[model samples]
Target: MRIYEKVHLVVATPGRILDLIEKGVAKVNNCRVVCLDEADKLLGHDFKGMLDRLISNLPERRQILLYSATFPLTVEYFMKRHMKTPYEVNLMDELTLKGITQYYAFVQERQKVHCLNTLFTKLQINQSIIFCNSTQRVELLAKKITELGYSCYYIHAKMAQTHRNRVFHDFRAGLCRNLVCSDLFTRGIDIQAVNMAETYLHRIGRSGRFGHLGIAINLITYDDRFLLHRIEGELGTEIKPIPKVRIPNLCIRCRNNSIMSWTRWSLKASCIPDKRSLQLRLLI
Candidate 1:
């Protein structure tokens, strides 16, 4: 008779993995290595308990690794509890990526879709990821993009895991030119073909990934004025305005014909004019 010891490698969400452990389907007693991506989010209030429980089931001699672009205060608790003199390697001295050119267009809430349409026509996008603030917005924006005669797909945290995985896989495989998603896809998505990203959040990291050249375009409204400035200060980078854009026969209803110019943009501050004026802001 021959006896064999089975060894398994599993990659799963903390909740799913914990469920399998609870059901006696997964044995982590001999687990050698546990790696957590987006460590800040996992250590947040929502998943911290489950992650703690999962770690408790692993062997005491196991190696633990935490990885994230930003390590917030939330991760301190987990490190203190689980790690013994852990080492951290921070490759970024600044928050923003050097390979990414950041820009923002100030538009009214209603004109956002129109502005985005213009950008789609103007920018040379290979594969782009558009990020919305909420799941509802993700769906709505995806619909609008599709209506604009573009190939698009949408994903969010609220969607089924299987569906989201399929959408992500298809998008990465070049099945779609654009993907509309929420912050759910912000971290750990590496698509080299993505040369442009439109985001309201600081998730512009989606582009310029793996040391590739890319651009990040943000659609800013009056409400997002403070946020734009705060991000600049935090990232220690400048966002600048795009050069003059000549909107020919676009019927934007501006006083100076259809020609819209970006003026008085600042590196130290964001000049958010009233809703009536259209200005483009750029961050470099």
Candidate 2:
């Protein structure tokens, strides 16, 4: 076992960390920093008991930072219960990331796969992650992409921890060119946020990390128009349609060192926003 005394950092889910603390395998009273990442989810009702127990044992004078993609009122409730004079940094509320470019492809349900395949064949991907809403789709998409000769792999909540660990390691090592995920690898809650508009901001954030450039493309049909509009309103940035998009490839890195090249990747499809149908939902 790694010596806990010498360990300066520990990353764990609340329930497991609470168990470790209860068994004296981990101690937090002397800890100087306690960060609740995706703290909105941590402070949710599902984790209320474990979170309460963990926070109760933390050192009183420590720096407690709560980070979340979107701060919901439940998080505010937890802050009132525990923190003193917490400062709110609503960065996303006021600004958009210039590092990443977002786009959407409107394809028929039957044509989505072909469009995705078309993307892979054209772009010179350094690495990219594709998210699906379901584990079954993650597996099926990974299979289809692999069969098309793209170097790809997948991860989801249902996979065993050991296998998931291996996949993560492989991805970081650059053994894989693309990853198909079910949002299991992404942070933030699967539940409703204050509004769903920032969903793309956080989801696309997985790319262009550490101040690098990234691109996010969503495959949407008629079913996703409303959700897409809400996302646009939230970011105040328009997601360009694939047909009228200026870039032929996904190389948007701002800190480029001669790896910047553009190609013509045009796919003609239509996703006209119907102003009358742009209804925002689940956004408080």
| Per-residue alpha-carbon lDDT of candidate 1 for residues 63-147, written as tens digits (9 for 90 to 100) | 9999877765567768888999999899744344655667777777788778777766554455677777788988998899899
Give the Å shift of residue 83 in candidate 2: 8.8
Per-residue lDDT of candidate 2, residues 71-165 (tens digit): 65677778888888988887543223454556677779788678777765555445667777789988998898798888888889999999988
* Segments of candidate 1 deviating more than 4 angstroms: 1-39, 42-67, 72-86, 91-96, 196-202, 245-284
Candidate 2 residue 69 Cα shift, in angstroms, is 3.7
**Scored by CA lDDT, what does every candidate get?**
0.66, 0.63
Clashing pairs in 1: 238-283, 238-284, 239-282, 239-283, 240-281, 240-282, 240-283, 241-282
Task: At residue 130, give the lDDT of candidate 1.
Answer: 77
Error of 2 at 152 (Å): 1.6
Worst 10 residues of 2 by lDDT: 275-284
Number of clashing residue pairs in every model?
A: 8, 2
